[model samples]
Target chain A: MDAITVAFAALYQFGDAFAFLVLSACGLAVIFGMMGVINLAHGEFIMCGAYVTVSGANAGLPLPLAILLGALVSAAVGALVERLVVRHLYERPLDTIVATWGLSLIATQGTLIVLGSTMGGIGTPLGSFQIGGYSYSVYRLVLFVMAIAVLAGLYALFNWTRFGVMARATIQVPHMAAALGVDTRSVYSLTFALGAGLAGLTGGLYAPTMTLVPTMGTTFIMEAFVTVVVGGADVFLGTAPAAVILAIVKSAMTSWQGQLFGQIGLLLAVIVVIRVLPKGISGFLLRERT
Target chain B: MSGKFVRGLRAVALTGTVLLGAGSAFAADPIKLGVLEDQSGDFAAATLGKVHAIQIAADEINKAGGIDGRPLELVIYDTQSDNTRYQEFMRRVLQRDKVDAVFAGFSSASREAYRPIVNQFDGLAFYNNQYEGGVCDANMIVTGAVPEQQFSTLIPYMMETYGKKVYTLAADYNFGQISAEWVRNIVKENGGEMVGEEFIPLGVSQFSQSIQNIQKAKPDFVVTLLVGTPQASYYEQAAAANVNLPMASSVNVGQGYEHKRFKPPSLKDMYVTTNYIEEVDTPASKAFVAKFKAAYPDEPYVNQEAENSYLAVYLYKQMVERAKSTKRDDLRAEIAKGDVCMDAPEGKVCLDPKSQHMSHTIYLAKVGADHSITFPKVWEDIKPYWLGEAGCDLTKSDPSEQYTPSNPPSKS
Candidate 1:
């Protein structure tokens, strides 16, 4: 292969990896990083999004509209979960983990019972373009763009909007925010819903490129969790940079060897990052700013 | 008490004893066939049809007055696609229920987990799924096609149809690994070169890197031994990337019915070699499909594994009738004679008595743009020649081992 072709391939691999890590961790950045709730059921929310999106698309809705419907439905479900289950366990962060974990199991098996094990998946839209002899998916590149859009949108929502201000205040100090007439309870619910919606968006976007199984969320869960852990609590400051670093490591390893080594290199990088920076990348960034 | 009362009691007692004796004399014991399959887990969708097929076979035999008036009773257990469950339930069916025989397992891992237990009880068991091959056990009967039957037909045809350069992507488990080995050897033997080979871990959905790698190698065609829901995504991703190279497999559409599950154009131009698919156009196959559909109105596809299991039940009934007994030793002896054959939906399939494996009629099927299947070639009576050549003669001795290309059996 020519050097130009090699460079394009390398760039494509990095972009794919970056998109994957960023999208998988985006929702968790809000729920776990911002809200201080460890949701083991995060994957199920993604599964829900994918299921709804595929069902909608099959029912004759346009693909983009189906994806939007997926995100909305997931947000509604997330809001309901916050009200019924998450509201009771906010003080006991550890208990919230167990509760959400139980919820995940029920949701997964329930989906299996209702929807069966497999569903007809939507075909990936858009065609492919070739660079030299190598061909690449236009849809995958779209995913890369989508990942960037989601991150930038989240940053704007939290930093620039009125709802974002109240949500942040509530997360930082629930009692103070409530005293200040912020309706802390409502903020909490909306924040959780936002997190879940982002997760659903992740699912809907990749639904076409994957086989729609009840357990398909697991494919994203590991990478999602790892990225979240390495990114730390700050979604804006940590998530984007962490994804870039990890993506670079993963793509380089994948290019040098294969996926197995790439995965090994990813986990090894996580361990090293955690050891050197205990609170994560965002924590380090926050410390540097101080 | 009056004399009339005493006479009445004695008569009643006599009638009761006679009725009990008549019941014992006329009605025979039901022959229990243990069925353990993945009915609710990862493989539930793919293997549920097999469980239903077994039911259909058993019901047909019972409807026909069974074997010499002994009803065929199914002792069914849903293993839930878990290996530990296979162990737990295999023991339950064998030791507790004392089932006459068993037709069980979907994956090779589950089979390996419980096959030893079946042997421990000296029970007759049939593993009815296409696998990596080279399992030679006296107490076991494998009705599924092996690498010898699958790859022998698939690799040469793929090479001739596509080109000399091949790329292989397989699941990391034994089935995929061994199958890939067969692909490599067969490709070389056919005077073709394997440009690249990669083993993908189970549950991985992303394939951009793998696709890019395949493109880099520029193989004329690809061989995918991918298993499970996640690996099935490779087709969709590859298609979207415009990798127009044709693909061939021994698994894929035959077992999982991927063509029916995935959208059109994803699986287009893919070829698979198998003993049965729902699309196989034969009177017997059509009848079987009709029966299966009638039994399960909502079932999407009647897969190859289901057909294997369905035929296995009938094969067992034939064995019992020939031996005139359901005893393990009697059936084993009858099987050793090597004349066991069943006219199944996939045409005539015979158990190779020497190796205790099946000889299947392999069909080469292609997926169209609309996801419809068409048979382009057929190889009849393809025997499990590899095991027999590797000295796996159950008639002479019981090896009770699975041999691979890396681990050949020691010639005695």
Candidate 2:
């Protein structure tokens, strides 16, 4: 392989790792990082999205529309969860972990019982393009762009939108926000739903590239948690940088050795980040600014 | 008064005797067979069909008046793809239920988990899944295709057709690890070079780096020993990336029916060696598939292991009949005679009493671009050659141990 091909391959690896980390972490970053709820059922919401997407596509809906329908359905489910279960445990963030963990188990087993263990998967869309001698998936590049778009869209929503202001206010101080005429409950519900919707979107997008199984969500959970933990409590500020750093570390090690070392490199990076920053990347950034 | 009382007592005694004779003629104790399989977990997709196949076998036997007038009753337990559950259920079936025989275990780990318990009871057991294939236990009968049957045919054919350079991608477990070694050995024996090999941990779905590595190596063919739902995605990713090298496997199309599950062209140009597939067009296989479908109208596919499980039930029946009893010692002695055989759906398969393993007729199945399967080659009467080479002669001595290539028998 030429140097150009090697460079393209390296770039491709970085993008793939970055997209995976960002997509997996984005939803959890919002739910656990921003909401302080430690929602362990985040992965199930992703599964719900993937399941709905595949079902929709199989039912003859177009792929993009199916993905949209998946996100909407996951959002609605998230809203319901927030109202029925998560609402009671908002004051006890630790309790939310246990409750959401229970919900995840219920969701996984429930999916298995209802839909069986396996489902036919959608074929990955778009063909490959040759780079020198090696071929690369066009859909993977699309995923990279989608990750950036999601982050940008989220940034706009939280910084520019009126609802974002209310959500942030509620998250910061629920009683104070309520006193200031913000319906904290609705903000919390909408924010949680948005988080879940993003997770669902991640699932929908990658559904084609993966085997559809009830336990598929577990595949994303570890990456999601590690990214969110390293990202800290600011979804926008922490997640992007953390994803970049971790993706670079992972892809480099993967290129050097293989996936096992890549994973080891990833977790080691996380440990170092946590040890150095203590409160995480965003927390350090916030302190530096103050 | 004495005469009347005596006459009444005689009449009552005669009625009781008649009723006892009627009951004895109608009901007999069922011959219990324990079935342990993953019905609803990770391995459920593949092993669920095996469970259904076992059910069909039991039903058919009972319909034909059962084994010597005793109904074959299945005491089934769902192991849920957990190793601990296999041990727990094995004990329940062996010690508590005292089942006459068992057909169980999906993975080598599960088999290893429960084999000791089976041995402790001196019970008869059948491990019916294709595995890394070096187990030598007196209490267990392995009906699945071993490496000698699978790789010997597949690797040589792959080398002759594809090229002399092979790359291996295997799941990082005992099965995949050992299977990779077999692939290496077979490739070398065929005068092919193992250009590259990677052991992927379970649940690592991302494969960009692995793909790049394979592309860089530019092997003539790739041998994938991937297992479970996560690793199966490699096909999709590889296809999307246009990794156009031919792929051969021992456990792909036959076990998970990847060609059926994945969309067209994902599994295109893939080859697999196995004793059975749902696509086997033989009359016996067709009838067996139809029977399984009839029993389980909603079953996805009748996998390779299901065939082993199906034939194992009949094989067990043969052992029982030959012994004229279901006692472990009697069954062992009968099986040791080396005459137990069954006209399995795959073809004629016989238990090799020396190794306690089945001799299988293997097929080389090729998956088409449109997800169709065609058998281009067949190898008949392939014995567990590796075990034999390792001197795993159960008739001579019961070592009750697994022999890997690196850990061959000392005597050998």
Measured by TM-score, the strongest candidate is 2
Clashing pairs in 1: none
Against the unseen true structure, what C-alpha lDDT does each candidate score? 0.87, 0.87
Worst 10-residue stretch by lDDT in candidate 2 chain A? A281-290
The digit string of per-residue lDDT tens for model 1 on A21-88 reads 99999998899888878899999899999999999999999999999999999999999999999998
Off by over 4 Å in 1: A281-290, B1-26
What docking grade does candidate 1 earn? medium
Worst 10 residues of 1 chain B by lDDT: B14-23
Judging by DockQ against the true structure, name the best candidate. 2
What DockQ does candidate 1 score? 0.60
CAPRI quality band, candidate 2: medium
